[model samples]
Target: MSIRLDLARDSGLTLSDALSVLLPTPAQDLSDLPRTTELVQPFKPFHDHFAAQGFSSVDASDAPCGDVILFVPRAKAQARALVHHACQRASGKIVVDGVKTDGIDSLLKEVRKRVPVEGPISKAHGKIFWFAADADAFSDWALSDMTLAGGYRTVPGVFSSDGIDPASELLIAAMPDRPGARIADLGAGWGYLSSRLLEREGVHSIDLVEADHVALDCARHNISDPRARFHWADALNWAAPEPLDTVVMNPPFHTSRAADPALGRGFIAAAARSLAPSGQLWMVANRHLPYEAALEAHFTRFEELGGDARFKIFNATRPRRRAGAS
Candidate 1:
């Protein structure tokens, strides 16, 4: 995105007169832009990253701005919704930039059908283009909140937005009737597992830790239980407010299209750190993912709890101390 912006600048595209710019869904800082640029990022780690760099960051923005730079996300519905949102808030030019794999080509084609699109400078397996803001042009692309079975509220771009994940369903069935008292659901996307865990006999309280603010907002609406607590946090680093008697998770295994087992490993380490001395962990994952090593390193005993061919469940106990003094 930085490269595309630099090329655009050299090709006579300018933002000198723009008083303020809104960067929505930016994965990283575009340092060349003005220091006052505001970032609209929902993912907790990215929001925290920009906040620490002295930039004003928010989960969402409705305030009008001089200009807008939208970095497209992978979800097509989400990408179009952001464009519609940008048109509503941008008073000046709206710059759209994204990689081809993120459906930039398709989005550009859609935008051209609505308004006159400017230079589509291609670089880095992506394209960047701009157009004048016209709210009415993209009005039809506006996304509404999604409602799944059992009245679960979700939104575009959240994991399992369409319906309950089959893996989570499998995990729920495999969970004991009385897992524990205090529990933490790491990477608890939209609180499906947490809500079910609340129904279990021994569960007293549950912390729903998720990275996506949008999903967390859905969770807040979907669950009205007083026993539930929501935390917008990176599950890898999130500290449980109290020592947890059990940790249940369907930890995300990737940040991008490619699968990364390390993400799941981090969740395992976090669960180990958050658990009480005798705490147990109940987790589910794809059958092919190699998480046994991570589980062995973090706990004294672990075993497969049986799952269908597509998924696997694990039960682990006796968390181990890290290689350092308490």
Candidate 2:
């Protein structure tokens, strides 16, 4: 990894400065750090880095802090909670790092407001900020009150945290009927689509697949259908244990800093793979995305179900045989 020393020096530093400087060292030195622990949230890129470090892992919510490292949530509010949580449980320093787009600056401000600490913060293409605090005094912000939407309280920084997404609204409006069978909502955000789908007749069970664990937690709480199941799995990489009768999604178009139309296209292909031979797929995306070709490539019949200038809903039915099956 390229060192953004210029930016790092500007942000402020504590134990995080030494660790960031030593990030490229041999794995043995990293693992050898006595009482070192690493934590990361649902973001794929962040998780990949933490995993590459080969640090012992734990679910962000349940991970405990001793005299160890702590990965805070990417969101500003959750990041604050993580700092407090670490301080509450551990006697040593806590290391918090995240990208700028995730709001590291705001997180630093929030942390300062809650507990005064002089730490290292760096800003460049993005930013990283880390501080040290007592785990015993660390707060559990998730347990605290937060603003709500559609009856769900968000910790901040999760996608579509403010309100229902207009694209999803269009997609949900175009959902087709599938009675008394298995259904899956890919990229399920706060259980909106699945919740609406369950209201239809003949819907037996719905699996809500969301990549962000916090989003999944809010979704599980938002929609209380006994048949609804939530899984924190990547949409492109995960396969269903059993084929789904219907797959509905508003798959993410961007992987990180830039828009990746391929990611959305990949979801189209993955949706096809996750379905039974005749299972139907319904999706909505921005009008600019060139997804029709991908949809047609994967499913036998692909057509625009609905849309406006900004978004379009597409319905594609899986083919009984492969392309050109004879």
- Identify the candidate with maximal lDDT: 1
lDDT of 1 at 274: 92
Please list the residue runs of candidate 1 whose C-alpha ends up more than 4 Å from where it truly belongs after superposition: 16-29, 322-326
TM-scores, each model vs. reference: 0.95, 0.77
**Poorest 10 consecutive residues by lDDT, candidate 1:** 16-25
**How does each model score on lDDT?**
0.87, 0.65
Candidate 2 C-alpha lDDT tens digits along 225-299: 898988887777777879888888888887456788998887887788878887888889989989988877788
Clashes of 1: 0
Q: Note the clash tally of each candidate.
A: 0, 23
lDDT of 1 by residue, 1-326 (tens): 38887788788776634433343444544665565777888888888777777778888888888788888888899999898988998888888888999999999999999999998999989999999989899998898998889889998899999999999999999988998999999998988999888888978999999999899999999889999999999999999998899999998988878999999999999999999989999999999999999999999999999899999999999899454311
Best by TM-score: 1
